[model samples]
Structure formats: structure tokens, C-alpha cells
Target: MSATGVQQVVAEMLQPYLDQEGFELVDVEYVKEGGNRYLRVYVDKEGGIDIDECGRISEYLSDRLDDKDPIPDAYILEVSSPGAERPLKKPEDFRRAVGKDVYITTYEPIGGKKEFEGRLLSYDENELTLNSGKKTDVIPTDKVAGARLAIIF
Candidate 1:
């Protein structure tokens, strides 16, 4: 099957288990890098996730994949936490991220540039308010190409 199809299938198969286990499904990614294919599943919970948790999820998923035989090719399976810099794909993610540091890239320039990194003040379906140092930028949600939680050093 196609890569997107594989992602959908795996996500469908994993959701029930995750929900029952008190885990949240963050995202599923299928990609080819360094001449190898990888299916990466990002998961999280109320506090966070640890290596042992990832291993347990991985072990369970490995068995399911073996039974379903969904991929149709040789690929490595990786399950882990999304980390502190988790991508904000849904509107809910943006909404929950208010008052947190975030890095955002727009499809086109918002204020003479495409990148904005600062504190997210507020978020709604129409737009999001951000404060970057001395400036506050109001960004249209539709214009965002990518967004992620950021750790400022």
C-alpha cells in the first residue's frame, strides 16, 4: 500500500490500544531516510513518557504489525514520545499552547519574514496572537505552514 495508507492503517489499529492504556496518540510518520524506511509513532500522556513506556508500546505495536502485515515491505518501527518540541498540527494543539513558547513558520511572510518564535498569547480558529520580544504579532491560523513548541536557551 501507499505510505499515507500505511500511516492511516497503523493509526487506526493503534488508537484503541492507546486509549485503553491511557496514552495519547500524537502523530504517525512514515518516511524514507538514508536509504531506509521507517515508521515512527509519537505518543504522550498527562505528564510525559519514558523509554520503558516507549518500549512497551513498541513491543505491542511490533506484534500487531506482524499480524496485520500492513507495510508490504521491510521497514523499521520506532515508537517514542514527541518530546518538548512537539509539532502543533491541530487547532487544539495551538489552543492548548497559549502562553507557551512556540516556533511558527508561515506559508508566506507575515511581517516581512516567514519565521516567528515567541510566546503564544492567545489562539482562536481565525487567528493567534504572539509576542516576540518588543513586538506582538497577530498571525492568521491558515497561513501557518508549521508550528512547534520551542525551548529557548
Candidate 2:
């Protein structure tokens, strides 16, 4: 199966378990690294997730993947927490991140710049307003190439 296909299958399979555990499914990736293929699942919860939680999620997903047999080749299954700089993948993520510092890169330049680092002032469905110094930038979500929480000193 294709990488995206595998991710979708895994996400569907893991949703119930995550919901029951009060964990949020951050993201999932099926990718090749060197000679090995890996299925990585990033999960999060209210505070943070511990090693024990990761282990349990791994064990559960491993068994489910084995039974379903989605992938044709031998692959590593990994379940873990999205760390301090977790990715903002969904609109909800952006919404929740309002008032926090963030780093964002656009697919194309906005105001002749593709990268933005500042405090997130607001986030609507289509755009994000960021405050950088004395200026505020309105960035369209479609233009975002990458975005993550910024570590403030």
C-alpha cells in the first residue's frame, strides 16, 4: 500500500483507542528512512503523555497493524508524543495556539518574506494574524509550508 493509504488506515484503527484514553491524534506518517520503512504515530493528551502511555499505544497499534496487514513489507511501528514544539497541522491547532509564540514558513513569500516568527495574535479558518515587533502580518493558511510552536527565551 502507499504511504498515505497506510497512514489513513492506521489513523482509523487508532482513533477509538486514542479517544478512549483521552489522547489526541496529532499526526501519522508512513515513510522510508534508509532501507527501512516506518509507521510513526504522534499522539498527545491534556498535559503530556508518558513513556508508559507510549508503550501501551505502541503495543495496541502493533497488534492491530499485524492483524489488518496493511503494509506488504516489514516496517517499524512507532508511537510517541509530539514534543514541546509540536506541529500545528489543523485549524484547531492554530486556534488553540493563539497568544503563543510560533514559527511559520510559507509556501510562497508574503510581503517578500516566506518565514515568520512571532506571537500568534489570532487565527480564523483562512488566515492567521501574527504580531512581530511593531507589525502584524495576516498569513493565509493555504500559504503555510510549515508551522510549529516557538521556544521563547
Give lDDT: candidate 2, residue 131.
90
Residue range 55-108, candidate 1, lDDT tens digits? 999998999999989888899999999999998988888888999999999999
Question: How much lDDT does each candidate structure score?
Answer: 0.93, 0.92
Residue 39 displacement (Å), model 2: 0.9
Candidate no. 2 TM-score: 0.96
Over the stretch 34-151, how does candidate 2's per-residue lDDT look in tens digits? 9999889999998999999999999999998889888898988888898998899998899889999999999999999999989999999889999987789999988999999988
Error of 1 at 36 (Å): 0.4
Instruction: Name the lDDT of candidate 1.
Output: 0.93
How many pairs of residues collide in each model? 0, 0
**Which candidate should be chosen as best, given lDDT against the real structure?**
1
